[model samples]
Target: MAHTAEIQCPRSISEEDRARAQFYQLLGTLLSAPPSSELLRGLASLQGDETLLGVASRNLAALAERTNPQDAEREYNTLFIGVSRGELLPYASYYLTGFLNEKPLAELRTDLMARGIKPRSNVHEPEDHLSTLCEIMAGIITGEFPCDRNLISQKAFFDAHLAKWAALFFTDLEKAQSAVFYTPVGSLGRVFMAIETDAFAIQ
Candidate 1:
């Protein structure tokens, strides 16, 4: 008879990991769709300290307070969905390979499969979409999947998919002509990505 071995359960995620995951999730949520009135209201209540990232967060909240859902929706459409293509394309493949659904996207898909990550049935965007990638990072930290969800795994995924292109994209977004409510969002992203990059480098 063959001997069976016990499978050790994964360790519980730390509080710091949970907070980091929530930040990624927040980014994913904000980028995934136009901000609803409730979301805008929540944004308007955000407060921050004296640091650069905190200042950016405060600015975002201030902008959110002044922005209405109708205007925000229009801005979203203009920035992300123009008549054909938006001013900016938020895809890893496009940023890295200069084309949609290119090699980067294919590589991301392969990795996602290897990690047993399946996209939601209703999600039509490729796995390399910025929002999708953010959500994946959050899931990885939260151990939403059975695979490796350690700090090393989180760092690997972020270094590969987000660290290179996400900051550039956010910088573009901050300066885009159509950006109003999203400008502060872009600033926040830029600062957050820099922090994440630096933190990961030191680890």
Candidate 2:
């Protein structure tokens, strides 16, 4: 839910992987912004011949149009700005070290800097923000970054950040009291994250 990056895909990817990467990128883009009429149009035009993503996109577009503003506002508050804090803490340091703003964030920033990746100027979250992490993952898998994200680096980074908490985050999103339109999104993320984890492990 913290997604805010604009990761571009490399043109050199195979067709299948490129489409897969596009789905993640679209996911990131949708999460980064509140739904707008333009985004609704984009979602409406999604090719839905055979992809769950396409179907989901179609539903998301319809839901976005029919979403009551009050309901969406409340859902946003409950998910991101609870009276105290949300049930899921989507931060890297929190997941890895069981603390916030710890060494894990520091280490991630170090790596990000080395890779010429910087958090967007408008983003107020820490460098290892969950959205940024997802963008990084998609970027890595798509070779959007300068270096190839070999299995070793992917495993190391994911284990260090997402592997520890993404499933829990998705589960919390799935069960969030305010979720309506977002519950299916949460389910999709949970299932896909698990699948990605296993795929990487076996590779």
Candidate 3:
């Protein structure tokens, strides 16, 4: 996903929403491009708790500590970009319709338009790209878009655009043969998707 306008959360936002937005942003940043040396170093410093998500985070941190930027970039290219095509096509349209720029993407664009969230002029990728979707979700939560900044709105968007396919994509990421440094990233995404699904169900 290409970079969008930066979003700053209001101080009145709840801690839970703040954390949720941050996680979405992190996933967006990592998946949009390979981690830089500075990003890798920062990731290596992360400490996680005892929960499944935390365990995945800790695992990611350990892997980051052992990974250099060059190796990580090579791995990223192998997993997401290759001589022909990468091991995975990480778009909702591809995952759901087995093709690029299908109905899912059209629907997402419509939703985004309604929310007053437009893609940057230079962005060539479809809005349904997983990384782009994550960034949009972060924007919704952080009030960067015109939609209501509440759980109901988040749930609607998640269920429509993400719930159908994101976790499955993450599972594929975890099992991909080219995965190394990204293995725990997949785990973290899978676990976080589950958490979000569960949390949304109760809302």
Candidate 4:
């Protein structure tokens, strides 16, 4: 369930930005998961109005069908965990505190507990893991929360974690040596992060 102190969004914004916030929430979710046939099918129902996301989504949809896991995995490893290490760590703690399982993880644990969110027992990754955070954003947007504080929870969590290192990660993803199908994914993430960050700023 989403925790609410006084019941409000993380920021005050116009109606239009709320819709955009939903977009970021959904984008974060999709990025966390490898492409599935059902997710691909659902994405086609959305229509965009010639925005950067609109164009990118169309292109992504066009390419998703041909995506091979073996190819994507090879690229993912080369970019995220190469022979030594990738150009970036793709972690909030590493980016913010120069190490994993640092204060950020401690802080995130506090927040998660407060909000009644628990890390899945089967998932051994740290709560501050990028993929886990992305999944949380999806849950927030999708009303998996026990309460319907989706937008507010989405904004708060994004402001707390993802709004920090996601851009840099996406940028690295864009330039990584093994990126091919992932190049566009990187571009989309980068662009979406920029848009979301700015919206949060102005809100």
Candidate 5:
């Protein structure tokens, strides 16, 4: 579960980097919980872009304009928290190894511990959850965690845990039958991850 709080910025970074980190935080927040009325309203106010991501942004904002909070909640539940399992399982472990709580998750936990990061006590989901991973990416950029990780460390973490699986998950989310409000989210995530992967490759 995501806390209703701002994404902390430990210090100043390039404006582009700051915006990228904010985008990750936004995705993390939206995926971790259903949108509140205020959040939906805020989303509705956003303008769409002309780029591929912009198209997704516009569509999502348009969807938000007509979506009631209750209906959005129901859609979220149906897509992510159906009675037992959701239409898609948004976990690194599952996406990587075809099983939940598998080696990928264990490896992620080890890496997180090494970086002096720990999952929130209230969030019972594994650290490999999509939302958790997004939060970690945001933290890496923002230095929200206690440790001082440089760009190299950030790239290493992304390559190890996120680069392989996140894009696939987003692609699945984009095509899921239950997706409406989440489709644009899927687009945003997919495009963002692609950008991250390419960015890290040359760094």
Candidate 6:
């Protein structure tokens, strides 16, 4: 779950597509594990404009500036890795089916196989993990997969795996009592998911 390989795009990617991919990558990285000191510093340097997502980004950057790695780790563990289970389960299967490793995970694995996308051998979690799905979306946008790289393909994947429940998960994250550094993360995700849904609707 911690390993992600660099993918060289086979074709030219537009700046907008690149930005979208980067956003997905950022979300995936933040959710996959606790932020390292370096990551926290980098996030602190981020700047945003007047857009809704930009506001959320700016808020996150502000929080990142005040957050130390140790506090961030503790917050992450509380939200995702408590004694029995975390405060929130960041998995699509659980969100959609009230359980983990159910039909949604099976469907995702089948789709991933069809797209020639596979999880790293070291990852023990199911493919339905929100972080994993976000990473896969980033890969698709950046032409990392063998399939066609277009809005149509992206929409298909989004509708199948994420459109159903990502916003709800983000909302829960935003409201979780253990959240501090992750509050803006949830806000950003919620806003982004709405934007994506609207964009995909028009396509």
lDDT per residue for candidate 6 within 1-203, as digits (tens), equals 33244465577899999999999989999999999999999999989999999999999999999999999999999999999999999998899999989999899888887877767887897888899899889988888877767999999999999999999999999999999999999999999999999999999
Ten-residue segment with the worst summed lDDT in candidate 1? 1-10
TM-score of each: 0.92, 0.75, 0.95, 0.72, 0.92, 0.95
Q: Show model 5 residue runs off by greater than 4 Å.
A: 1-9
Clashes of each: 0, 0, 0, 0, 0, 0
lDDT of 3 by residue, 82-127 (tens): 9898999899999999999999989998888777777899898777
- Clash tally for model 3: 0
State residue 90's C-alpha deviation in candidate 3, in Å.
Answer: 0.4
For residues 1-203, what per-residue lDDT tens digits would candidate 1 score against the true structure?
00111233656788888878877887787777899999999999999999888999899999999999999999999999899998989999999989998988888878777777766666677778788888888878877765588779889889988988999998999999999999999998888889899999998
Query: Relative to the true structure, how large is the alpha-carbon lDDT of every model?
Result: 0.85, 0.66, 0.89, 0.65, 0.84, 0.90
Clashing pairs in 1: none
lDDT-based ranking, best first?
6, 3, 1, 5, 2, 4
Clashing pairs in 5: none
Give me the candidate number with maximum lDDT: 6
State the weakest 10-residue window (summed lDDT) of model 4: 1-10
Q: How big is the positional error of residue 109 in model 2, measured in Å on the Cα after superposition? A: 1.5
Compared to the true structure, candidate 2 yields what TM-score?
0.75
Q: Write the per-residue lDDT of candidate 2 for residues 1-203, one digit (tens) a residue.
A: 23223455544767766665665666565444445556656654554434554455555656666665566656666676678985556677887678889998888888776665656566677766666687777777677666456667667767876787777777777787777766656665676677678877887
Model 4 C-alpha RMSD to native: 5.3
